[model samples]
Target chain A: MTPKKVTTTSGSVTGAASSFSWSKADTIRTSVAGVIVLGLLFWAYLLSSNTETGGRASFSLLIGLALGIVFERGRFCFFCIFRDSIESRKNNGFLSVITALAVGAIGYAIVFGMYLPDTSGEYLPPGAHIGPTSWVLAIAALAFGFGMALSGACISGHLYRIGQGSLRAIPALIGALIGFGLGFITWNTLYLRAIQEAPTLWLPHYIGYAGSLAVTLAALGVIAYYLLKSNTESAPEKVSGLAVLRSKFSPATTGALVGVIGTIAYMRIEPLGVTRQLSAISRKEFEKQSLLPETINGLDTLAGCVGIVTETISNNGWLVIGFVLASFAGALSANRFKFEIPTIRNSSTALFGGVLMGWGSMTALGCTVGVLLSSTQAFAISGWVFFLFAFLGVYLGIKAKVHTL
Target chain B: MSTKKISRVVALVASVALLSSITTAPSQAIPKNDTQTLVSADWLAKNINDPKIVVLEVSAEEGLYERGHINGAIKVSWTKELVDPVNRNILSQASFQKLARKAGIDNDSTVVFYGDNNNWFAAWGAWVFNIYGLNDVRLLNGGRTKWEKDGRPLTTAVSAPALGDVVAKKADASLRAFLPEVLKVAKKQQNTALVDIRSADEFSGKIFAAPGFQELAIRAGHIPGAINIPWKTAINADGTFKSTAEVRKIYANLGIDGKKPIIVYCRIGERASHTWFLLSQVLGYDVKVYDGSWTEYGNSVGVPISNPAGTVWGIA
Candidate 1:
């Protein structure tokens, strides 16, 4: 990035680059965010003192904190990444996804090997929730992809965007919850039919862990090779007013880090899932009203898109809080946090997009975190299925956006 | 992936397979039958030759047992054997007696049940036997999964054990719950807990049925104030029932203390049987399997329904 020339009253010349420039405003913002973060950690620690489950919950929140920081600074929003590639033909953003998938796949394979020393059996890796492969899954993923295009962000984006004081995020979040409700209502019918008939296929089940690993890596290689080879342009230098904690990072750096962090989260507690907290909240409310059925179809002890609705503070619940707070902290550090309320048009679209994402994710048994990222890494066939349909949905959504006023 | 890329990756994996003999470690020790009501793969493996020991595979899939199952195991289809051919009710006592004799089971038989879908239908078979007062009934812990995982020998040969006398008695009220009794439990709210052993969506009446199944009910919702704890929670990762203490604690946390009489149900009662076994036989609770379940309740006209999703027919 080009540095700007700055001359203080003292007749000395100095070049100031991005993110390092300090100002009273930056310091104030950082201080406020830091205090809030420390407060949250203290609360989590306090919670942990009561039980072992509390301790795990706190650790999960810390993991989410790291995720929030990386996501905010790296601009790792899936919507923007795909949109930039499909609309502008700029491919840099795509590199991050590729790198993340590469790292995640390797890490997951290692973990799977350790867990299932005898990989030949029909055991589904615990906690992966390798959901049934069916038409329902494809349609759901397509819906989620379309929602991402419409809302300008997926579930993760909405949370982090709110950290930056984007008021449109509020509607998006609300819409997602509503969409989740809709998904829950229709889940039984789907579960009994298509989902029941659909096979829960895992790559390791047939090919062995090594074969699945090789296949996944080879696929990623082909994608990365073409992406890197064809894209000749580097990013234009970023120029911002009154920079605080902002710093430019390569997609490889952010992606690899994301993969490593996500794997670690999965290894210790559960896979990277964002909707558990939201759905849990909705489930609890329904439970109170006695509106829930005696049983839901398909969902049992599995962890994924439709997570357990619990009265107690779950690990994912705490993670949700930590993600939002840490995202704010990250934004403040980078001086990227700004309160930008959307116009009626943008907000309406975002809300609808949120609804679509929620419904699609519910049907698919996960969002980006649960399906495309985590399942893909786990070598589940649903990963490939979701990948294909979601990309198609995103591609068409982008085209539709271009055609609209 | 595109067709070309898929083929390429498949070829690469296939080539890799040729180079190395990839060993897959199947997850070990199918679920253990820890409680009195269950038997493990190891236990069943050791006892299959006993004259009194009979292993029956009752699965929703018509030909699952025929494909490859435990050696000498008999197949029992839910629709064909357990339920009435014409009505939704369970088979009559005479029908039960006939089916039991055909499978070569008698009053003294130590019949063990197992099946695919994590023993979803096998549990139902166990419940049916309980109603007919089968003295010694057990579910194979981890069911077919444990049997297969441990590398137990599976044969497709049909069994022809000698028929023994087994008379079907009156329906056992202690094990089965009727709609009126369930309604009474709801109205009274005494030391009786109605446990909905289904997934969360079914509890919420968000949808009429699961993804693959056609709608089974006219309405969607739970009985008034039923606690929604899916049946599979009682099961371990290997498809075995969890330890008694652990399982007891899970229900206890859900306010279903063993002291309280518990009524368990699922969409059509098969899944509920799994939970019923866990509560009544494993955790030692006074539990009743609601055989009518959601299908009966949701379809009933003007019955008290608590559909939180406010599900309307054909609309979520």
Candidate 2:
């Protein structure tokens, strides 16, 4: 039997039919992307018009837009990045993370020097993502990493993926809500037992900015070097001009952009975090149902995305909204937007994994973006601790072939 | 029946109108029976069941009221309820009236304010209540700490009393000082005394704010020429106010006599309200709290600042 032939728009010979009808699909998608951009602009205008949270929310939305574009174009998913390194021994994606840490650390050092010139003083930089270092943090990171492996994405990864029409993310997010409730339930005992007494070590506090920056850069340099040495993949071919918008950004480029965005975000608004709004929404719901403890037991005093029960959408909520919408636009422009139907197996696993990630993030006070990325940039030892344990958890989960489940 | 009869009627009407006017005028004096500014916990305990007494627990601590509050006390969040939800100002007169009525605060009610954290926020509540011209607002002397330490009764029960008919007056400008008024004192152009009621570190520009506080200023320092009298100086270790004579002496040593109009301030005016209460209510001095305190003064552009710590942003 002869195989059927597909015709092109120009009536030329073809094989392997296009995913969808090609004649108007591209134009429709491009138009939709344009409309999304317009929508974002209108949303920003409305946010800025609000008297209470105008400037802050607007700024956050812009930052979120930048982050969304970078994350989508670079495919900056922690789960995928770790999986490549652990399962296939491809270390290129991991290099981007190191690059981001290095760039962000430098930026943070400059900002910190300006904010708190004398690091010898007991004062910490305001709004920096510095949290107490404890066993609980380590355990939380491990769970988070394992969940990433299980659910196929981290919290941020799931958020961005939702923009690409990943249906499984919906259940996972719902599961995360339940997970946050559980975290609140267990917070009091854990806080009193360990987090209360834990040491919040800022590297600059001990060694000064010069020494801290040197240490951070040197460590990142070593990691980058190791990643380059082990990486088997060749560098991607360079693309320029208008094509750049449609093409995937190089990992280094993505990292550098993310670092710049993060620094600007920290300078203007709060630290780069995605889970604060999610956690807050969950917390508010739980409080309404009388599920949360009357007090969160020193949670407010500690930093890193403390969830407050509020009726109005916070600046962080605006940031998340911008992130999702901009990611959708990016996906659409790249022709990567596809509505993936959720299978029973994928849905169940995603939900379970999301629950673990949510519990882990809530207990740790942040996720990869908040803790590992933002905290490390600020030279908090907690960030490095989280990085190590989270990597280990991913490695173990991948070795166990949890992703197949 | 003409001019003489009309004159006689006019004279009678004038005398009656005069008598009514004299009788109906509002008195400025506090009733002789309730003159105390600082009420003892014992006094509150005895009057806990008094329908005319409304106790308000104003706390900065989250969920503190739910955990336990003084019996018959209503919870008031210093951050949420006392201030405007949108603007950086006190609650509007209309909003204050609604909150007051909801809390069963009648015009004649003797409102006693207390809270955790050494009664810093409770004093702020008292100041806000005073701003709306509540006549008989009082502070619990030792606040929650002393009460808890003395093993006084606390309950988780919430009261839902009948709505009150309290009418809120226009916010009294005399009780609250604004930035322009404070700037005059800071620039030393005005003869008023500026009392900075923050920790020594904060006053010295060594730290922006008290540790763990969310509110902050861009620059670190106190207003130029402001006297540093930490609010805690007026309180004993037991969280009760020092005797009036001692407090007077403490201020007198700093050259702040009742003669000069004093403006008290802290990071966000809560601690300053504590000092405001001490100076105006207890010591019977002319004082006002600059609600826009260090957070305002430090952040304001081109404002004169004194940083003896040699702290400059980005300069080591």
Candidate 3:
């Protein structure tokens, strides 16, 4: 009897009459993806065995892997999320950010309680992303937001997108390097003028942890309410097992997972930040070329993603590596990997946007993930300021149609 | 005949002994110079390759030594390596001996200590080494900051020299002042100079500790009768110790003429170690570092404190 061929959504052809039949190309792709994933795991194992930074590096890598998968599966790009809400009036992605903030804030409260039981403004939790609230931070966040709109992605967005064969990420990252150098050059002046005496206010210090959590959740609820009200799309149908793995995850599920990952990352290694290693590399190169000031004037003492010049790969560096590779693996497995040749216009725009982002992140002491997500979770007032100004910047950029330019 | 021979021999022996005493007196009277306690960055750069000179980088900041340090320098953690982690005390004699031997320090080795943060921890390391009675211990003048500022070469290469056969002496009590002795001075029972080596804000009870520091006292103030002299005052902009005359004059202006027994302290003893180096090592004064410092003293119950700012714990 002749067998009928059936094409599956996963790009696999199955024989109807036969008990089990799969496409050879699909089988090869799946196998290669599995091998790549296993190789990444082995690399993480090697990193774990390092004597100096083994434990933290390993934890960071694993967290990055989880983040990569979530970012890919959930489409958790900051620019895309904002763009969806602004341009298309889709609020699911925006709601995801709200959910993430809510979940992460609770997780941070629990951790903060354990680390620093007394939040009476006397002591801050060690290694938390609490930065000074100042005009410089406002300007930085606005620039960063505009960069996100123009470049088609935030710093972390560019990172995960690179996995999906985005060639423009190269110029963007290179531009970021130059931007960081410039940031270093101008750091002393900005720091002395604005950031030197800025207040680093923590919500828990004033209202206690419970009150802070309530306020945070209430704020998130308000945002989620507006988002759901604006969303016109119908609810997605539920899928199970293998189909679930192949399909996009719901915003709620994605946000929950991201929150859990962030909490775990903080508990084990450090707060979620994608810019430390990048900034460190830039700072080191600038110092070598005599482009930076002798002293960065209180840069090292301030909290946030303070990058120190180092020859060895830091935990954050390992995290970035894992994020990129695991994202690549996820893309390959989902059949989403497609190499796009970069046009000159796109490349130049990406580079310019990346420069603004890099400079903004440096001046502000962190990017979206570091400042907005982590700092807000920690209940630092700086995070809220960044959030407000960044949204405004993106709104303005979208109105100006900079993304198209 | 016997009496005449004995008398003549006695006279000759007395003359020879007097001549030997005259010969050694001038050498003994010549005081120790700056080179004995401090080595310039230029001097270290020139002699960095010397085997007898064991360079040690003692930093409170993490990953600094691994990032880049003076070539062939040994990394020493001020928190972990220098102190007893379990007990709030300096490392045990056996542990210090082990550390010294592991770092290839010998009895005759010229140990040059340098570190980040203006050599605050490096001077602490020097103080610890002094307690253990290590001979030929010197601090790197200007430390890591000066070396980097001068565009000196740094390497990420870590040195692992052969094990040394050095032994650490029992900790010298004279070099370290405990709370009891400090209390006596605070109570005016002892005529001692108490130098509070913390910032003016800290000394005046305006703040419990410096920003970003976790270790702090519940009560914000300083010991009674202690004078506020920030440790940074002893160092130049380049992080090197000021000239002996300048340092002495600075202290003399504050009525600390090194005549009385001196006890120097800061928040965690590290900054005080810098001042301790200036007073005890450089100026040749009888000084002891109160290693327990404000963390211990201010936390102690019923201790006399002078809080000029009138700050209260958990209130403001």
Native contacts recovered, each model: 0.00, 0.00, 0.00
Candidate 3: residue B18 Cα off by (Å): 68
Provide a comma-separated list of chain B TM-scores, one per candidate: 0.86, 0.88, 0.88
What lDDT is obtained when candidate 2 is compared to the true structure? Answer: 0.83
- The count of backbone overlaps in candidate 1 is 43
Model 1, B1-316: lDDT tens digits are 7764664466457545544432321112222233656777877776665555678998765335654678878878787679997987889999899989978786767788999888988988998998898877888989887777677888756666566587778888788998988888777745579999888998898878876666889898799879999877888777888877887788899899887788998888888998888788676678898889989988888678898998798654
Q: In candidate 2, residue A101 scores what lDDT?
A: 87
lDDT of 2 by residue, B172-205 (tens): 9888899998888877789998999899998998
The best-first sequence of candidates by lDDT reads: 2, 3, 1
Which regions of candidate 2 are displaced past 4 Å? A1-24, B1-316
At residue A76, candidate 3 shows an lDDT of 91
Off by over 4 Å in 1: A1-20, A232-244, A286-294, A301-303, A402-405, B1-316
Instruction: Return the lDDT, model 3, position B283.
Output: 82
Q: Assign candidate 1 its CAPRI class.
A: incorrect
- RMSD in Å for model 2: 23.2
The window of 10 residues in a row where model 2 chain B has the poorest summed lDDT is: B24-33
